[model samples]
Target: MEKKRTISVSVVNEHGVLSRISGLFAGRGYNIESLTVAPIPESDLSRVTIVTDGDAKVFEQIIKQLHKLIPVLNVVENDDFLEKEMALVKIPIEEDIASIEVLCRAYNGNVANANEKYIIVTVTDKPYRISSFLKAIKKFNPKEMIRSGTVALERY
Candidate 1:
């Protein structure tokens, strides 16, 4: 069966590291659903968080291959990971601003920017909650929407 998975890889912070890691997935014909990469503070390592949906057996092989990569320092499977996603939606200024702010607050979000033409609302929450927020905000008729896909950290 196919299941969504998140893998966090601690890798050497070097040029082309991202491409090599991504190439590993492409070479295997696996698709990455979302990917986030950032340097680990005060270190020569970066954390790459990848979200993919695929067969368990094939996913395991990918993890094994990740472990074998020379620049890979560590591989963390999705177990006990706290995942969050951020979504930004632009709504027409004609919409009720107060109502939009109230709705955003309910989803742990707030009005991030506003101008003569539109309001940009930002939300950060669990992926599922972000999805709910997007669905709920549809009534406001968003002009543009973009999501910063899943960023995860392991929880002890």
Candidate 2:
């Protein structure tokens, strides 16, 4: 059955690495649902987190192809990792700030900023929790919102 699969790849910090990796998936007709890439702290490496949908066979093929890439160092699947995503939501300040704060608190978030026009609330958590928090706060009508793609690390 097709389902969401999260993969984290460690690769050398080199130009065009992302393009080559992404191109592999594109060339194979796979669609990436979410992708996050950032330099590794104090190291000459980067981490790429990709969320995609496929069955067992297709997912295995992706991992095999990923291993063939010269720059890739390691590949990890979701079950062996911890993941999180962040979202910043700007809601109308005219709406109840107190209630909003409470909701944010429940989701490990807080009012990052408050101005005359809007309140910027930030939440960092599992992707599903972030999605739920956003849905619950829609009554305030988010004026602006941004969500980061999945970032992950090995469970060890």
Candidate 3:
């Protein structure tokens, strides 16, 4: 059966590693829902967090293929992963700024910036909470919104 899955991979920091890893999925006809990659702090490795929904069997095959990649150091299927996402919404200045700030605070966010034209509010929370924040903020009629890909780290 198909289900949402998050896989965290540690790889040597180098050029074209992202392309190669992503290409592996594309070559297999797998659809990646979200991907976030960044170099590990004070280390020669990087973390690549991928979110996808697909058949378990196919997913395993992809995992196996990932292991064969030369740069890949670790491949962890999220068993105890903590995930978070961030979002920013631009709302018209005419809207109630206080109310918007209140809403943002509810989602672990705050007014990131503001001017005479628009107010940008940012929130970082679990993915589902980010979705809920987006939905709830719709009542304010935000002018623009952008969400970041999921960043995950495995728990001890």
Query: What TM-score, to 2 decimals, does candidate 2 have?
Result: 0.96
How many Å off is the CA of 17 in candidate 3? 0.4
Q: How do the residues 1-156 of candidate 2 rate in per-residue lDDT, one tens digit apiece?
A: 998999999999999999999999999999898999999999999999999999999999999999999999999885876889999999998898999999999999999998889899999999999999889989888998889999988888
RMSD to the hidden true structure, all candidates: 0.9, 1.0, 0.9
Instruction: State in Å the error of residue 50, model 1.
Output: 0.5
lDDT of 3 by residue, 1-156 (tens): 898899999999999999999999999999999999999999999999999988889889989999999999999995588999999999999998899999999999999998999999999999999999999999998999999999998888
lDDT on C-alpha atoms for all candidate structures: 0.94, 0.93, 0.94
Global CA lDDT computed for model 3: 0.94
Candidate 3 residue pairs that clash? none
For each candidate, give its TM-score against the true structure: 0.96, 0.96, 0.96
TM-score of model 3 relative to the true fold? 0.96
lDDT of 1 by residue, 1-156 (tens): 999999999999999999999999999999999999999999999999999988889899999989989899999996699999999999999999999999999889999998999999999999989999999999999999999979999998
